[model samples]
Target chain A: MIVAERKPIDEILGFLSKHQKIMLLGCGGCVTVCLAGGEKEVGILGSELAMARAKEGRPLEVVQRTIERQCDFEYFEGIRHEVKDVDAILSLACGIGIQTVAEAFPDKVVWPGVNTKFLGVNQNVGVWAERCQACGQCVLDKTGGICPVARCSKSIFNGPCGGSQHGKCEVSADTDCAWALIHDRLTRLGQVDSMREILPVKDWSHSRDGGPRKLVREDLTLESGK
Target chain B: MSNGKDFQPKIVAFCCENSGWLAAEAAARLELGYPEKVELIKLPCSGKIDVLYFMKAMEKVDGVMILACQKENCKFLKGNERAKSRVLQTQRLLKEIGIEEDRVTIQYLAANMGNKFVEIVQNMYDKVRELGPNPGKVIK
Candidate 1:
């Protein structure tokens, strides 16, 4: 899931300082599962912002909506009338959803209410950790399913870097050294030979180093657009 | 609604059925009284309360009190513990937005602790009155 956290309240307040009314948009995709930008989150933030504004005597009208998935253009169609009612939109979705909503409604003043943390998995109730960097590559099969690109402090390949101490990252005592975890996992699986294989230098172009990435599906693309 | 000497803070109490709710019923049967302005909202368990509900309650009331079972005494094992965590999280959210974190609180008791229930509520009522109206209270 795309995990995110709400931005600081003061920063959010700053964004809407000049506006009297705004829509609090939420996405029911990854954020909802992570307990961040869901319906309940939207309600909580909406009530807080309204009260915060009312305290200043400026008051604020919050039009709250949680679409199924804000990244899709069609999910937004149901709330077109709501968009027309507010001065701006403050989205509590991931970076993609926020940008998608902004691009879909170019005329509206759209702002982000959350900071996209990472592509992560729910480790436990109320806990999420990054699991993928979306490097346009998959290395899980080679690394015992532990992601070095995300879990390692340096994204080091074939590494328990010199900084790894006692199976923990030197950067933080609490963080497990990803390479150590991989080593242990591979050792347990009797696949230590794969770990010793010298990996080729990774191609950076497949990842964000090549700039904004886009996926095109010729099989799915409409003939008219082609 | 008067912000003067006659002011009464509007308070909402979410009482877990196994504890606070039964205690409040006992208090009523005993003819003990609490401020009418402090309303009681009964729920299955304190754990069932969500942070959203806590914030939304602020829209209608000035103060919120969660009445849950005592630590280690919840019928559902860790219900009160979860409620306590949620209350703390809710208060943190409140404080971040410049509202009094004390405006929301939690109390633990049993089905027979009627006096404690009344005592804590009266304390909340008095404290909220001193703190003045909730800045988060929505204007009509």
Candidate 2:
């Protein structure tokens, strides 16, 4: 899931200072599962803003709403009535949802309430760690299931670099050496020979450097008249 | 509401049923008295109390107190810890809004601590009295 964290309250207040009435929009998708932004979070943020404004002697009115998924236009269509009266919107979704809503309501001011962190998995109740860099490639099969691109301090394909000591990365004592983990797993599976095969230079064109990426399937598109 | 003395701060107490609520009930059974200005809302666990409830209560009350089980003693395990973090988060929000951080607090106690419950309530009442009424009350 995409994990994120709420921005500092002061920064959020700065964004909202000009507006007396605002809408706190929450996403019921990834942000909800990650506990960054959800219905409960929207209510909390709305109350915080209201209290802050009230303390300043400039009372604020906030409308709280959570849609099924902010990234989908169909869910947003149900919230048009709620959005009509707000001066601005504070979205508690990932970057994609924020952009989708901004594009949906071109004339209104929209601000991000959370900082999109990374593509991650929940390690425990409240801990999430990055698992994928979305490099537009897959190499898990060659290096065991552990991802060196995302977990290694340096994305070294053939690694356990000189910096790796006693299965720990040089970057931090708390970090496990990704390559060491990959090597250990591969060895257990009796596939240590794969380690000797030198990998070729990666294609950079498939990543973000290739400009904004998109996926299209003409057969699945209604316009294709399949 | 003033009572011919100094400002009587209105307080809202959110009590966890397993601990704080039981303490309050025991206190009542013993005929011990707490501040009349304090209102109690019982919850299944401290984790159920959201930051919004505290902020909304602040609109009408001068202060809010969240009473939960002590660390490592929560019936639901980690519910009190989650509540503590939420309280800290709310406190920061209050400070950002120019309100005193002391306006909201979370205290841990056991279900059998009836006298302790009364003592904490008294302490909060005194602290809030010094802080004065909530500034947000008038704006709301």
Candidate 3:
């Protein structure tokens, strides 16, 4: 899932210095699962914002709402009336959700309250790490379920670089070498022989390098003639 | 920072029912005096206090004291530890916004330690009094 974390209080306050009344929109999607932009986070941030402003003697009016999700227009439909009243929107969702809300309401200003971190899984209760770059391609079949593009510090296609030392990445001792993890995974699966396979230079066309990507599912779209 | 008036800092204390609440009761029974301006709130567990509550308390009071049981003695296993983590995180948040991080603190104690409870309260009262007042709130 996409992961995000709140921006610093000063930066958020700087963006809202001009607006007295604002809506804090929380997403119940990936951000909620990641514990970043959920309802509880919205409350936490709203209180912080209020305290910050109140300290400066600039009282702020906050309207908080947590929708089912913020990346889709259907979710925003439920709170359009509430959104219309606020001078601006402080979106506590990821980059995509913030953009979607801005696009949904072209007339109003929507500011991001969190920085989009990455596509990752919850490693533990309060810990998360990057897992996928969404390179728009799949190579897990060869890498034993690990994405070299995301895991490996250098995105090495074949195996560990000279930077791999004792199964840990040279970038940081805390980071396990991706190839080492893949080697162990392949060995456990009795597919160590596949490790010799050579993967060519990645096709960057599918990723963000080829500009913004789009997937139009012909089956899912309603036909105009229908 | 002096406003020419006596600075009787208003403190809010969140006490755990399993341990800290009992200790506060003991303090009351023993007549070991604590600050009259301090308000004590009882919770089922210290872990039940959210970061929002801390900020809210700072909005009105000069300081916040969280009283919980010692690590191994926690009735809810890891409730005190969880409260400690939140307190640390809340301190960071408070510091980020220019509030005195020292205004928020957590203390661990057993129910039988009523003297220790009074000591902790008096220390917080003195600390908060020296820290002036919560910049988060204007309690004039």
**Residue A211 in model 2: lDDT:** 84
> What docking tier does model 3 reach?
medium
Q: For every model shown, what is its TM-score relative to the native structure?
A: 0.96, 0.90, 0.92
Ranking by TM-score: 1, 3, 2
Give every candidate's TM-score on chain A.
Answer: 0.97, 0.96, 0.97
Cα lDDT of model 2 by residue, A1-226, tens digit: 9999999888998999899888899999999999889998887777778877777778888888999999888888888887888998899999999999998888899999999999999999889999998888888878899998899998888898999999999999989999999989989999988999986777867778788889888767896454
Error of 3 at B132 (Å): 2.8
| Residue pairs with clashing backbones, model 3 | none
Q: Write the per-residue lDDT of candidate 1 for residues A99-139, one digit (tens) a residue.
A: 99999889999999999999999999989988999998888
Candidate with the larger TM-score of 1 and 2: 1
Error of 3 at B63 (Å): 1.4
- Write the residue-wise lDDT of candidate 1 on B1-140 in tens digits: 46787989989999999999999998988889999999899989999888888999998788998999999999899989999998999999889878999999999999998888899999999999988888777754
Q: Give the best candidate by DockQ.
A: 1
Q: CA shift at A125, candidate 3, in angstroms?
A: 3.4
Best of the two (1, 2) by lDDT: 1
- Candidate 3 per-residue lDDT, tens place, A79-134, comes to 89988889999999999999999999999999999999999989999999999999
Q: Taking the tens digit of each residue's C-alpha lDDT, what string does model 2 give over B17-124? A: 999999999899889999999999999999988788988788778999899999999888989999998899888878876889999999999898999999999999
Q: Score candidate 3 by DockQ.
A: 0.52
